[model samples]
Target: MITFESVTKRYPGGTVAVDALDLEVPDGRTMVLVGPSGCGKTTSLRMINRLIEPSEGRILLDGRDISQTEASELRRGIGYVIQQTGLFPHRTIVDNIATVPLLKGWPKAKARDRARELMDLVGLDPAMARRYPYQLSGGQQQRVGVARALAADPPVLLMDEPFSAVDPIVRATLQDELIRLQAELRKTVVLVTHDVEEAIKVGDQVAVFYPNGKIAQIDTPQRLLGDPADDYVENFLGFDRGIRRLAFFPADGLDLQAGIVLGDGTTVEQARRAAKQAGESWVLLTDAGRLPRGWAALSDLESRDGREMLAQMPLAPYGHTFRVGKDSLRAALDATVLSRTGLAVGVDDQGRVVGVTSYERLRAAIQAAEEAADGQGARPS
Candidate 1:
């Protein structure tokens, strides 16, 4: 656990970076410090590893005063990752990951072996072990940096905008990877980021930093979204906070209508009759494997002269599918909005369609989710 007791960082020009801050990061959980630039979030992170000395107050690491320890010694025990991964350009991936372990007097073979293990742990292939940093992609290099941090098996990890340097797709993949790693390793993690969405995605608890090194609010991401502390925090969370809040609510038990679904083998006339019977303007067409094919409008089916194969007929695209057992309400709603038939397709892990949810049903789910969150006095974690 890390405890900040009235910690403050004052510059030589009498400017305060962090002012009278008090915070606690519990063990084996991720705590994300997030806010706008110059809000002192980075300063607070640096102070934890003594990269930036505090001008006032004390910081305790597992109840030991960090100031009493040597800077290099303290940093060696805590893994740190940054936006621009400071990898050694001259060193191979394995040597880079084994740097700290080698410095700490581990045998070269043992350190290299540990590096190989971490390479696999962070999703890097063994083929890249001998390659230099320049030979790897931006995402791959970031993985190497993470592997290097975990090479020594540090109990605490500090990350300052670690995924900010990558593209959005890669950034999201990295974020998920970090979450997966944290679940397996359970490291005490304090990550700093300006992206509120990223903080919400990865943090167990999020700290919203304000100007002058003050924390505006600190709470779980769901709680923070369900009930913002003030206008500033709410505005910083962006205008789509309500939609974001839905991400916490599971979509498993959502009521789905399968009556509107027809198989691809279903004839155009059969589809027309089924759509008329169900009173739906559109019918979802599925394949023999129960996978969603597309949507067939009732008018389109009716226009056909005879029993034309539904598979051969023109159909509206099925935009996307959400995993009913795995995805959230936000995903289901997104699927519904993207769909041409105004219905969201719920699928299992194998991408086979389970059923469809309408916009009205999604709205009811949202209301129920909000009411449940309110009744519990906190949103789902």
Candidate 2:
């Protein structure tokens, strides 16, 4: 755990970089400090490692004052990542990863072996172990940086716009990798970024810092999008926050409708009966396990007179099916919009048809969820 009690930073000319900030980052949680330029985000992170000493207040690391710890020792125990890859151009990837371990008096062979292990841990191949930083692509270099940071296996990890240096595709891949690593390693991570979307995607808890070293609000991404503390926070969350909030809600609670499903190899007569029972013009065609195939109009089957309804051509294709219990509302909504029948096919984990949900029903669920969230003190009065 890390605690900031009235921690403030002052420059040589008395310029304040960080104000009297009081915050706590729980152990094994990814705490993101996000804001625009001059918000003192980097200063706050730097102070935790004693790179930029605070002029006032106290910062406690695991109940011990970081101020009391020696500066060089304090930095060795914290993993730091920055925007640049920061790998030494002259050193091999393995040597770069082994920098800290070597500095701490680990044998060269042991450090190299540890470096190889870290490379695999961060999804890097040993083939690149002997390559220089310049020989690797930007994304690959960033991976080496991550591997180097984890070389010491510090309990706390500080990242400052680490993925910002890569392209969107690579950045997204790195974000996913970080989440995967955190799930396994569970490091006490404190990351700083200017991107709100990145913060929501990567952070367990988000702190919105404003200009002049002030924290606007601190909350989970769901709560931040569902309810903003004030106008500044609401604007920062953006207008599509309602839509973004849907990603956090599961589709399992939706009251899905059944009976519109038709079995594979069913006769025209059978489909007609099922369609009539469903009170719909068309019945959804499903495979033997009740997984969706396409939509077959009852009239088309009726016109066929004596053929198998399953053999009849479909009116329109089924785009996709949303997992009934696993997928989120956004997935259901996307599926419903993409489907020709204006309904999302809800399926089980095995891809068997469970039921279906219409766009109206999906929208109503969103409204209901918003209302429930509002009533639970997530909305500003």
**Most accurate candidate by TM-score:** 2
Q: What's the lDDT for all of these models?
A: 0.92, 0.88
What lDDT score is found at residue 175 in candidate 2? 99
lDDT for model 2, please: 0.88
Per-residue alpha-carbon lDDT of candidate 1 for residues 1-381, written as tens digits (9 for 90 to 100): 999999999999999889899999999999999999999999999999999999999999999999999998999999999889999999999999999999889999999999999999999999999999999999999999999999999999999999999999999999999999999999999999999999999999999998768999999899899898889999999999999988999998588878878887788887777778877888888999999988878888777865788888898888889999999999999998888789889999999988899988898888888888788765333
Model 2, 1-381: lDDT tens per residue?
999999999899988989999889999999999988889999999999998889999999999999899988888889988899788999999999999899888999999999999999999989999999999999999999999999988999999899999999999999999999999999999999998999999999999987779888899888998777888888887889878888888898788877777677887788888778866777788888777888887778778775555646655677789997899998899898788878778999999988888877897888887777767774333
Root mean square deviation (Cα) for candidate 2: 2.4
* Candidate 2 residue pairs in backbone clash: none
Best by lDDT: 1
Task: Give the clash total for candidate 1.
Answer: 0
